[model samples]
Target: MIILYDISCTRHNTAWSPSTWKTRYVLNYKGLSYRTEWVEFADIEALSIKHGFAPSGKRADGSPRYTLPAIYDESTGAKIADSSLIADYLEATYLDTPSLYPHNTRALQAAYEAAVLAHLDAIHQFTAPYLMTKKYFTPKTEEYYRKFREPAFGGKRLEDLLPFGAERVKQWERLKNDIGKIAAWYDKNDRKGSFLLGETPSWADFVAASFLVWLRVIWGEESEEWKDLETWHNGRWKKLFAAVKKYEAMA
Candidate 1:
């Protein structure tokens, strides 16, 4: 089983996009062996072209697929696009260890969106201010925000980076506040479960854990807000940490 991951270089990697972290988690959780290839904002499109995969509408070279996070399977001749789609692919491909869609498929997906997606939003709030002045994709490109993430989703950054105006600043504030809500939900919903899907981990936890990984790293250890937020995220972290440790021992 060969898994090709579409990841970012340290220079271009965004703290948001739970999909990226989720992919890494799934790979580690399943104890699957895979190799990672990092792509820059400028070279992503050319790489996609070489691989014949395009997920976004425009490209770094000015063609299309301004999107990132494209995965290809060399063994199966199948390439996967988007973060959510990639989770489904990982779940289906790794059936023996654990399944993302364990039960109550509808609720699982709903929570995934509500919780995991919320983390993505929070990540945006945490990082967007810094990203506004800095170019994440390609430094040589004229557009700082990249054409793909431009347009601003309801005055947000999904369409494209629109200068991170006052509207975006307010949007960031709203997203930053959302962290409390996510924690409150976890305090209520998580109960005694080791992972998000009761006992076994799910795609929900896979992506959710990434939020914690970035948050802890981004905020550092002194953040009381981060410590408070851990009521929800820490469980997943402990689980994945143990799994990775075990996997390493196996090596």
Candidate 2:
């Protein structure tokens, strides 16, 4: 069994972090049995440090800065961090499961994963402030969320970044264009279905779906943001999301 450490809130009672969503998707896609270890934002750094987990990279001061989505494999007493690395570990360890990178396409898988992450980074510019202001967070987690995000916004308050008027429209347009470009590639690939790889879902599908799941978290599923997105590429986002929606049941 694997124990997945996830960032979660008491209100939602489910995994809330986007990065963790990738791992959850992979675990469920492989049909592996795992349990969640939910942690608040405030405790992640300390908890990770206590478990001898080092940061993905060092800060300017060379201090380790840890984040969530780390897992502890009970069967092997092995612990791992980072979503991409975790995916690699899972793939190599569980050869019997459906392959994330079918047909030895590790390089291609890496390329798709990187592109999805880059798009996610852009999406965060608009989603971050909304996440920061959500009322579902506990007091400590809410405090940590604001403080942790300050550096990303150059010490400006998170609430101050909320887009308005033309700025809001511009951000939505950029997001739509981003989705449109990716959907265009999928459209031309001629998959003939929801998945990028035709009938079978692949790592690329998980990567794309993870971003959609993240968006649903930042805004409710019924939000106008989603409504606008549902109209793009003949509802490609909706289709991509439906392909992965079954995994949510596992969570």
Candidate 3:
């Protein structure tokens, strides 16, 4: 069986990391046999290094940066890191399963993933404050998260990053407009379908849905922000979320 390395959070009822969700969606969509090994934020580096998983990237100071959503495929003795690389490994190894990069659209799918991240950049600010709450993280993980994130915010407290009131409303409106821009991309799909490739699921769909899942998990499904999102862009996102629901299993 394959072992997927994911981040551990207080919310054990569901997986919440958007990056790991991409791999989880792929694993569940392909119907693969796997189990999750949840690691806390502070332990990711040590555990990854001990297990010989390669660094996913580098920090600003050029030190190796380790992250979760890595995998140890016992059958093949392959230790893979990074969600995209893990998807590629699974696609290549599991020939009998569904293809993530169908129609030889790997390059297009990569581009679409990049575009999604670029357009949703503001989401970090919108969701960062929630990470400090006990509802989402423990004191240890919250401290780790704070140290990892505060430098980027110029040492501001997470609560002050986007305080409630006019500034928050303006940011919310901006996020809505940005999501509308992504909706415009879906409109060009040639045929009406819940996925980017009209009626067929692909990695692009997972890339998009992972972010939606992140928003839903962080904001809570019944939160006013999520309710607003549900009706945006002619309910495009809500429909997409439904389309991907079948592949949301943690196993």
Per-prediction TM-score to the true structure, in the order listed: 0.66, 0.93, 0.96
- Give candidate 2 misplaced runs (Cα > 4 Å): none
Please give the clash total of every predicted structure, in order.
14, 0, 0
Number of the predicted model whose lDDT against the real structure is largest: 3
- After superposition on all CA atoms, how large is the RMSD of candidate 3? 1.2
Per-residue C-alpha lDDT of model 2 across residues 164-231, encoded as one tens digit per residue = 89997887788778877778868876647788778888888877777778778777778887777777
For candidate 3, report its TM-score.
0.96
Candidate 3 lDDT for residue 113: 84
Segments in model 3 whose C-alpha atoms lie over 4 Å from true places: none
Candidate 1, 242: how far from true, in Å?
8.1
Please list the C-alpha lDDT of all candidates, in the order they appear. 0.55, 0.79, 0.88
- For model 1, residues 1-251, the per-residue Cα lDDT tens digits are 54444545345333334456666666666776666666655566677777766565544456555444666767666787666676677677767866666775746576557755644544554544434444444454325444545544344553243325787577645655565455445456545665555657666655555666655545544676455544434443445444433322111
How well is each residue in 1-251 modelled by candidate 3, as lDDT tens digits? 99999888887756788999999999999999999998888889999999999999887778999998899999999999999999999999999999998899999999988888889767777787787753577788778877877877889888777656888888888888887878999988788789999888999999888888888988899998899899999899999999999999887
Q: Which 10 consecutive positions of candidate 1 have the poorest summed lDDT?
A: 242-251
Candidate of highest TM-score: 3
Cα lDDT of candidate 3 equals 0.88
